[model samples]
Target chain A: MSEKIKILYVDDEPDNLVGFKASLRLDYQVLTAINTQQALSCLNNHQDIKVVFCDQRMPNVTGVEFFEEIRISHPLPVRILITAYTDVESIINAINKGNIFRYVKKPWLESEIIAAIDEANKFYIANSMLFIKNEELQRAYNELNKFAYSVSHDIRAPLSGILGAINFAREIDDVEEMKEMMYLMEKSLKKLDTYIISMHDYYSLQRGELKIADVDFNKLMDELKAIYTVLSKTNNVEFNVTINQNEVFRSDEVPIRLIFNNLLSNAFKYLDKTRDNRSVDVTVEVQKGIATLHVKDTGVGILGSHIGEIFNLFYRANSQEAGSGFGLYNVKSALLKLNGQIEVNSVMHQGTTFKVTIPSI
Target chain B: MKLAFIVIDDSELDCFVSRKIIEHVDKSLNVKTYQNAELAIEIIKDNPIDNSEGLTIILLDLHMPIMNGFQFVEEFEKLPIQKQKKYMIVVLSSTRNANDISRILSYNGVESMLEKPLTLEKLTSLVHRVQQGLN
Candidate 1:
């Protein structure tokens, strides 16, 4: 069995203190404090005390003042105030000052007092766990920062070489020759930029300050559609968008945009080369407080085996395809922040479809 | 005779820049550029390379509008082996993953994978290797 939690009960009257110890000692390690001085002494001695139940009224000093004085030095124990009905105003003030977790009226039932102690114990344990987790996260953040710095340096070295080559080609007045070198340089630079952006986005999502708000689905869809319109025209691809419902869905707009933009951009970029009639379809539907957005493209689709890893960071299905491969990774991270899910289906040469579902705010 | 090369990519800037790089390395080399892979593949299929003359190299871009580089490879494989042998395929992409690199290598006819906005050193090396292999 686990060691029992320690609790301290402080009162001016010896009888009340004895009554509390006799009842609570069966379930917990109870310590009795007959006055303010004795309570402070017990707190100083008992490092494992999880909670303190202090009487609001005492001869020399109030419970609030005593708890406040010791708050900085001994912070682990949760403090609860005990008071009669007449002392309600002072107890409320104590709560405001952060000295009291809760106040129990005088002549309290044994079950009520026990319940308060149990609740305080749970709070103490939860806070301790949170502190441990926060420390672990800080360590991870430091390691990631170091890695990002090294990766940036590695990427920049290659880019500088490529840039130098491009500049040299241009300086020679070799018009035809400079064109090819410029292309290669651009490719290297894009790869570097993609890597840096992906690392930054991944860390930001992990930090979990997701700003959620009500977003107009229709407006967002229209804006995205307009951006892709030019690309669709140049490629001779027909893009269609259908909104099943006009109702607004509440979610983090930024992540939602990130998910849809990546999926839609991929659809346009990888359209089927053999087919003369190329088309991409986007549909939005809201049902039962769930918003589902579907994006389908008539393109050379992903192989069944490769579909599972599409969301993985730095994973590109085909090396020949020009992409950072971070797009889908960002989409996945953003979806997680919004409490959303994505599903993909594709046939080898037919097309690919992605369905994204998000909880409506 | 010097080899004639063609670049297929969606970015006009990429095509222009890659053409310049290849030309810088080998001035006598004949190069053509296409903004889309489908158009480039169609031209390649229509104008079969003459094996008696010299080899033709196709600098293929993987991400394109109609037919991407991978789809072109799948279709290009269906061509007669004799016609395929007259041409060598090189993939130009921005992707940098081991799996993606291996997938390109898996193609039966691809000569090499070059990370894109094609650089002088990489292009020079590729041309040198091809010339050495032919000799």
Candidate 2:
């Protein structure tokens, strides 16, 4: 059995105190206090005491008065008033002041007391858990705020560098030189777009307002493939999509779009420049109630060690590759919000594949 | 006589970009770039630009390592009215926070707040606005 829950009982009569202890001592760690002063003293001594049962009639001070005193010093310990028919007015007052969790008459059932203590213990545990969780959430918010400031400062320098080069290129009258500069400017602008998109995703997710809707998986995949078709053609890479299940996928399409967009864009961006066979294959299948999609690419694969932290914010696998390092982080965050899962497989020189699973709702 | 302008920003690239854009907009405009607020303040106080001959426009960056835009403004307010009137201050900042924008607008001599990197369209519009105000 688990540790017994502690209970403190205060009564003026020796017989009543003995009877109560004898009845509850086996099930509870019953502590007896003969007077109001002794009850307060007992509470101070045993900090873990969960419930306090006090009799209405006592010398010099009543049970309600003692409860009021305990309320100031040890507010958390649940209070239970033991009263007869005569002290109903005082019992009502105790309840109104929030001093008592419940009341028990003088001729009380052992079962009733046990039930009340059990409920009180549950309340105490739940309240404490909530308090701890709130503290953790507050700490995370503070860390995120600091992270945003540092990231903005770091990114601004590189952006200014790119902007300066663009301006310098504009001053030169040579057409060939201007074309080369425009190419470089386009590359930098892509990086800037990636950074801004990631920042937007991070802030929006932190705000926690993801709009969920019914989405057509087949149509969405077709649209994505069409969007990247021109880029794929320019790079001499063939893209294919295969869907085994043609069911309507009900989830937040926004996050799903973000995840798929980043993954597909990465596949296109990091294609094997020297390889003759440049291709990407996207396949989806449903088993039972779960839908899984696989995106496999013949591209520059990730290292084994770097795979673990690929989803971490600002973590780049290859610094040489033009990337903001926020794409995968956005993908992971979006998947988490959608209650989906992703797994990556890669062989350094061969290729990389990402498998994503979502529950069909 | 050419209009004299001072660009205060920690980023060398941003300073260069702003200077080029301003010069492009008005060919006769004489532009000076400073890497810190303190250096810019020193030049403004020690040897004041001639107000009647040429208008001076101060393009102040909000986020700088040594001294920020708000602190620069506080210090600039202490200068004589003639020296202040010789120049119109335009805040160049990347901060989109409402509180920061509101605070910048609250300052006495600030002409307007502009977001960076300063595009040609924004720079030209700002110049026209300032030129109209001066006349």
Candidate 3:
């Protein structure tokens, strides 16, 4: 223990308290008390005290009584009772009641006291670790329950729509109507395909270890432009990219790619059809050890009330267009993995802008 | 007086299919579609059909942004007793969640819960059941 483990000792006799602190002060941070009242105050002041030792025969209150009182107040610190050979029966009762961890003899041997302190510290560490693990497991279980519902809803909704379209097409003889049905079917299939791809991104980002390397924003932006150019042309929305970087930025490329891909897709997907001039702009700046990126789009912006909940899993703000609702959630998760932050600014029918910052690994 | 049908679902494709199948089953029927639950509720609150005209069959979707199907039913029940009698609500959803199914069924305004992709047979049977007072 580089830093001493704190231990508290309480006894009625002033000589006993001094002797205990003198013997163990070098190895442990010993806080001694002359009475149960002093011991309670010490516990309140130093919440991190790992082991509490009390003399069984004390003025006003006994060791067992103090242990029982503190059992509810300061439950974490392991309690030990110091008693004589004559008080064996009471010590055994205290141990059975789970009030104390163990007992030290009246004339304590230094070795026995050291052994008790070591064991108590180990128990404290193990208990805290178990508490943390249980919390993590509970969070994972809750997420899995949500995943189950989202999977069935997201996948089934589109599939059932496609099936219904097919059924309707079978009865109609009009060529133009048949083509319309085919278009609807294609749209549903595309939504399903997008959902499946993002689901893949979700799993990989969750399980995969971060592979950090130098992130060249220029190359990344070029690749994104190559993929989204055709889509931008078809929708008649201008796509612009600019990068200003003089420093070497390092991070996990996969998550950075996932984050930008989702953001850009959303930028293109929600443009206002009534607007004649629509544009999506991207700008990246790296300075010192941080990279700041912005994706601004001229689209039908999100409602003000929906700003806070957009990142929630399976939450959709706009029902007019078919969306998997996993895009922003995936982006948030990936940013969390990389210790990054994202912020959004938008106004209805005006536009939206997303800003992100990442620190070099 | 002829019966009328109203479909309130967020999905445009689902609404299209439902309207087509509903019209094909009986060309004489009148169908209205709403992509938002709030707009549908507003229409009902503003101009509830008269009981002497005909019964209105409302096919409501369970999942929608802002106001969901459950909230819509609650709002519908808040209307006057005579106005409520002019329409019958049937829940339409793609969700197989047991709790959602049971909870929506518990609403007094909801007649029955039907799965997604409304077919000609389902519509025909529903109309027959309503006509004979067997629902």
Candidate 4:
């Protein structure tokens, strides 16, 4: 009781207050308040006052009125009212309307007072626990809603196109026409496949635990370059990577890879095809336990109005391009998990730049 | 002279389907395909659509590179009123989302909204409407 739980008792009579503290002092670290103002001061000074006891009859205000007033300022402390025969009605009213946790008659025995304190303490714990759990549950429900909304809209839209094509293809028997329909079916299936992959990446980032490791910037840059080289050659894309690292940086590599993956894919997807000098440049520097990665692309840039919402799931600034719209959103969450940050600078029709900074733990 | 029909969509397959459906409905309708909305807007803004010729209709896809369907519609709406009267606009989409439908339908120039694959049944009615004109 001295280490944790503290109890406060308010009474007008000095002898009764002293007697009450003397009885329960060993069981509870008890404090006596001669009036409502003194009880409020005790509550303000001591955060551990879990249960409060007040005499029903006082000079200025009744116990019910005191409980009702303190209910606003010190709502966490469970209030218990003490009354005599004449104030039984007042005690009942306090229990009903003043948020009183329990009540005991005046000249009560030690066992009865102890029982009231124990019950009020239980009520206090349960009340606080319920408040904390409700907040957590509300957050979980919001995340589930985002996942459900993305799943329905992104997956169903592609499925409808595939179904419509299959239904239309069955009626046509011409070889050339059938060949064309087969191509359409193939495109729809590929789109579905890409969407499923991004969905997997999304849920994995959301549910999977992070495992930190020392990342090799040189190897990572080489891998990225090798994978995109074929595209660079075929599409006339000018791709470059420059890395400067002097220190060992530690962080989860999956999210870093995903961040690069999404940014690189966007670089290729949104490139201005007509421009002769289309390029995507990646620059990385690691120093003082901080790694900075920048991806710059000479692509069809995003408009200023759409820059804010680009990371939102299923949001498309240029909806014509086939994108799962999960890439940037996945990148955002993954960066958050790694305690990293990302920024975007874009000017419509000119180009776009993405900057990311990550700290090693 | 054959009446011109402009089909603006990012997907080549969708353009092919739309053109095929138009051919089945009325071979006389001259169909043109643009992969980007900017080019289509340029053609409209340049007034090369030839109003004195027969009826002109635009089958616009809601999603496209450079400029999206709504942005293109906003630009097209800025064109001279006489040119707007010469052409009928209809939006084609794979989305059955009520917001997209209601929003697109709210535009005065848009004649109707059609779902994907551009079925012959939908094309027949569109062809009929083109032949009937605004009269």
Candidate 5:
């Protein structure tokens, strides 16, 4: 066979070792070791040996002792002990403790050894697959636990504030005091509403399978401008969008919208109050199967030390101001799922720019 | 001796509400408000009142951006004992987490915690406790 698995056979008598090798040579890459010392040497030489058959009665060490010793250095090899007695106490102990995967009687049958080898190989594979699956399950469980705790904490904080304000408002009568309390109530209500919307975005991103479509950039730009025009007008800011399409751009429309919405809203939200002519520029181009988009804003930029941590979940870059802080984090997560990438460059009072790239299949 | 009162919170409205409640407990009490913990720490460290005599009470919010209430307490501890200006801190928080409350209460100068929308009853009880401590 072209893909023969390697195996080793160890015994005290030279003739038995040679006979074992001669019998299995055509089916496997058979190796022979005369004593415990030579068996260790063969193991060191053939690291990929899938199974080992060792005689129970050796000169200085029992097969159980030999298996235990090699287990520390070479643990992956499936071990089989060759016992002289029908029900030896030490052989039973070795099998019980998993020191040896199996055993064969002294006058070994050719069919018996072959059967043991087949079963031992399958056991090795199953055990390794179980280890990998366990790790994956543990990781997924930890992520869900963290997300549930954080979502409950964030959503409840604003609601608690609103409830307390309503309780206090009923007993107060002065006009100015009433107006002030109403303002606080409105702010807390708005914060609660914003948090709920962000949670909705999170679930949508997680649940839905990606739908591939030929994205229309011009139509998307018009829609975004129409939606944000009122906000830009109130804040005295302008948005400029340009596109250069060398190929037909195609991707999941939902993720594309999610990325742009987060970036565009942040651009206008943090517009600098000191600058008279505030603007944000968005440019897109596709060439050689790569779609590249850039969003540059003359807004209050992130700090240098804080830039690395901005994409972290619930990380507030500036703790002085109130932001849900999930916008950019969501953008990054969406990009990862789409097999896309993003990079950001920012200067403290000057401006910020983000470059994003996604490939076309 | 003037009874100096300070309220440190991230919300402007929360600061306003606190100032109103502190005055309602003792009308003549000198009350100050800060929208962030850093500003209050600056005022406390750089500029102490000239003729202050009574025990200073601070109402501190736990979840500010740059320097939270716990971080402020850590920084406040570095000040010399005499420069502490006879101040005691009370956490005013919206969090109902028992673990957070128990851990925060273990700090050196933290005297108590009152769940938010700081009510008149809690303020009245605090005033009575302050008076009793004086005796």
Candidate 6:
């Protein structure tokens, strides 16, 4: 109902063309042509024409011939031939060849033409929907394949590390060596834990519904500070937070937390251990129903070449730390559902900053 | 026998385990670890021939960031055949990808493939095989 279904009619006789247009104009956007050439031009100009009707008798070409020719190029538009009883043999041939959808008898009634148009339009809509769904299914299949492959490696790699550490731990008796083995084992377990959590986040973000609520940035940051403060104290890294919100912002609380947690954890995880004073600065400002956040960290920054690929699923920029490669990808997915944007600026071995902006619902 | 070992893997923990297992087998053996495949390739390129009497065993992981194990083999194969023989390239990867396994094994430069978390038993037999000139 958005617009009339477009149909193209071709006939050698000008009067026939006129009659066809006059009868179908109220029901469809009727496009008429005097010959096959004009009909081809009509099809070229109006790509959206869903149905095409051609007269069987013409000067240069017959309706069946035109339909057969256009079958290769304009296959999407349903084709019907208008002919007399004498051309029944050729009509049968055309229909058998899969060139024409159906044929209409000459001196046709409006009801017959209307029936053909309705049926043809239905076929067009169904075919288009199938094509789109096919493409979506293919994309999903490819992502699922990559997801399964990466999941195996992400899960197996940590388990292998833990196994190896255990074997070494049993052979050594030095207390320092035993403690070091425990640390390594703990690190491996933590990596596995992060991978599992992000996998859960990925699943939820894909299938969960958005629950929009009034978001207070101060309270959210306070909650995050309490958790990350303990983490920062262990790593000897400074965590600073600043929040300024004069306007009420609304968004899905779960996704907002997911984004912040992933980004902040990455900030702490990738901190440059060689630096004397490593720090992560988080700034949140809300104004005019838009929340802008900046997460800057004095960590081992991303390579310029790798910045473009960092958001890709299972993409890891550096192997200096134990990472599941799902953190940034999850952040990007969450931000997409929130109608938000993120940009990263990084210099190798110096620092990295992520700037994110989300419009309130 | 004076044999040197090189462990190339992006994972720090894996590298540590490989080093430990190799040392457990032979404490006096010189074992070097590289977190980056490119850096490991640079060291191999720097040393044209095994000046030492002993052959070097390179334990390479297949799934590194910049340069993978297969890519390293491709680059190493480009070197002179004499230099290639001075060091035996052993693929120490945790990859279960069948295509990757067959493709890397097809390379003449690759001596053999081993599952990661290089166990003491595996290293012992590998060193024994190398000592007997059976690789």
Q: Write the per-residue lDDT of candidate 1 for residues A1-361, one digit (tens) a residue.
A: 2898899999999999888888878888999988878888898899889999888788888887778877777888999888887766777887898877887888899888888987898899998899789999898888676555445443643454465465556546756555666666677677667667766776677776777677788888889988999989999999999887656567788778778878887898788889998999999898777998999999889988888888875566753435655779889888887888999999988999999999986
Write one digit per residue (lDDT tens) for candidate 6, span A1-361: 8899999999989999899999889979999998888888989999999999988999879888899999998888999889888778888988998999988898899999999998999999998899799999999999999998888877887788778788777778789867776777788788789789899999999889999899999999999999999989999998899999988999998999999998998899899999989999999999999999999999999989999999999888876656678889999999999999999999988899999999999
Higher-TM-score candidate of 3 and 5: 3
* Candidate 1 overall lDDT versus native: 0.79
Q: What Cα-based lDDT does every candidate model obtain?
A: 0.79, 0.80, 0.89, 0.82, 0.81, 0.88
- Winner on lDDT between 3 and 5 is 3
> How do all models score by TM-score?
0.50, 0.53, 0.91, 0.71, 0.82, 0.91
Q: Where does model 4 sit among the CAPRI classes?
A: acceptable
Pairs that collide in candidate 4 are: none
Cα lDDT of model 4 by residue, A25-109, tens digit: 8778899999888888899999779888888889999888898998998888888888888866666776777568878877898
DockQ order, best first, reads 3, 6, 5, 4, 2, 1
For candidate 3, write residues A260-317 as lDDT tens digits: 9999998988989989999999999999999999999999999999999999988888
Note the residue pairs that clash in candidate 3. Answer: none
Q: Residue A91 in candidate 1 has what lDDT?
A: 73
Q: Please report how far candidate 3 places residue B88 from its true position, in Å.
A: 1.7
| lDDT string, candidate 5, B1-135, tens digits | 356688887766677677777776678988888877877888788865444467788999886666788888888887767767578898988876767788889988788888887877788888888877777
Candidate 1 lDDT for residue A76: 80
| Fraction of the reference Cα-Cα interface contacts (below 8 Å) that each candidate reproduces | 0.02, 0.11, 0.55, 0.25, 0.30, 0.51
For model 3, how does the per-residue alpha-carbon lDDT over B9-125 read when each residue is reduced to its tens digit? 877788888888888888988899998888998998999456476888999998787678999999999998888888899998899999999999999999998888777778889
lDDT score of model 4?
A: 0.82
Give model 1's TM-score versus the native structure: 0.50
Best by DockQ: 3
Q: What are the interface RMSDs of all the models? A: 7.7, 8.5, 1.5, 3.5, 2.3, 1.6
As a TM-score, model 5 comes out at 0.82
Q: Which stretches of candidate 6 lie over 4 Å from their true place?
A: A10-27, A30-47, A57-75, A87-90, A93-99, A168-170, B48-50, B80-82
After the best TM-score superposition of candidate 5, give how far the Cα of residue A311 lies from its true spot, in angstroms.
1.7
